[model samples]
Structure formats: structure tokens, C-alpha cells
Target: MMEVIPKQFWEGVEQFNSGQFYACHDTLEALWMEASEPDKTFYQGVLQIAVGLYHFGNQNWRGAAILLGEGNNRLRRYPEVYSGIDVDELLDKSLTVLKTIQMAKPEELALLKLGEDENLPLPKIVRSA
Candidate 1:
């Protein structure tokens, strides 16, 4: 049986994909607050990743690392493709971004540019076909 995805979820995904991290957080959080079990966790993971990117954009290395790590850990609990999303891709890309952030020295953190980095482009949410 196919699970019905909410319109707001897609809205959140659009926000995330467009680099509107804060808006993505706001959109998904409403769903997360009322969701149950796996979905609750799933929404949280995506939301955290959005906020992590938000932190990264603001040059808050510590916040970016913490939330990205936490979000990746939560998302790992599900299958590679959960809720019609390409979870495997998301996990891989986000982990790459997280690792890149983690590997940066404090002095060099501010110089790092996301999406512009050839090896560490901003992660996007890809819906499974």
C-alpha cells in the first residue's frame, strides 16, 4: 500500500530545495509537531538538516555540525527510500556536507562556501521517481 504524502510536506521540500532553510523548518515543524512514530522522526530529521544548512549559511560551524549530525543519525533509522524520498541520496550528500564542515579548521570555517564548493555542494531533497 502506498502512503499518502501531505501537501505541506512537498511544500517543505520545495523550501528546502530552494535553499529557504528557515522556511523549510517552519513548514515541516508544523507537521512534525502533530505526527506520530516514524513520521515524527522523519520530519524532524529533514527539518534539522534544513536548519543545519541554515547554520552553515550563517557560518555557525558548531551549530551546523551538531544539527547535521543529529539529523543524519535520525534519518538513518529508516530504509534507504522512505516516504517517496531518495533517502539514500539525501543521507550521502548530507553526510558529505557534514564531513566537510567537520573537517574545517576554525580559522578556515568562515572561508568555506557551500554549493560553490565543487566537492561539497548544498544537499537537496530529491523525490524518488
Candidate 2:
């Protein structure tokens, strides 16, 4: 069962889903700062994902690749559907983006489909009461 979602976390989710990666980073980072133990890892993972997207937005392929890889690794530790998030789907998307970058040569990175302006499909939060 899903627990009550915190206001800040919900806000972060909204920002993240709306492609406001920087805002998501800011919002989730605040939540992560006050979180503990397992939740801390969860929040950190989300925050890292946000920052990784932000880096992708800024055309920082290397930064995006590193952070996205690390973030997904942390998130994989959680249940497949923890806190209303479909971890499996999210992981798949992250992996797609990572592979796209990893497969490209530095100069050819611009030809990748996972660019900053790309309208990539993102995972949504399955909100629970």
C-alpha cells in the first residue's frame, strides 16, 4: 500500500513530470535533506535523477550519463512499485537514455535521441490515498 505523499514530494513529482527538472531537483533536495535512512536513499535517488535530467537539458552528456546511472542504481534497491512509483518502468527509461549516450562517440553525442529538447516519455507517479 502507498503511504500519504508529502506536499514537497508531491510538488517535486509535479515539477519532474512537467519537465521542470531543475525545479524538481530543488524541491526534492529539500525533502531529501530532512529524510532519514531508506527514505533518504529514495529522495536522493529522485534528486539525482532530476539533476541528471537537468544536465541532459544543458547538453552535459557526461554528467547526465553518470548521474542517471548512479540514480537508477540507488532506486533499483526499492520495491518495484515503491511509494506509488513504477520502479521497473522508470529504470527502463533511464537505461534507454543511458544507453543512447553511452553508445555514441563524444562528437556524435549530439545525434542522440535523448537530447535536452526531446519530448521523452517520463514515468508518472501512481498516487495513492
lDDT, candidate 2, 1-129, per-residue tens: 336657898899889888898999899888889887678888888888878877877889989989998998999898877777777777777777777778878887765545343544443444433
- Prediction 1 global C-alpha lDDT: 0.93
**Cα displacement (Å) at residue 91, model 1:** 0.8
Q: Which portions of model 1 show Cα errors greater than 4 Å?
A: none
Per-residue error (Å), model 1, residue 5: 0.5
Instruction: Return the TM-score for each candidate structure.
Output: 0.96, 0.85
Clashing pairs in 2: none
Error of 2 at 32 (Å): 0.4
- Report the C-alpha lDDT of model 1 over 4-100, residue by residue, as the tens digit: 8899999999999999999999999999999988899999999999999999999888899999999999999988788999998999999998998
Q: How much does candidate 1 score in TM-score?
A: 0.96
Instruction: State each model's CA lDDT, in order.
Output: 0.93, 0.77
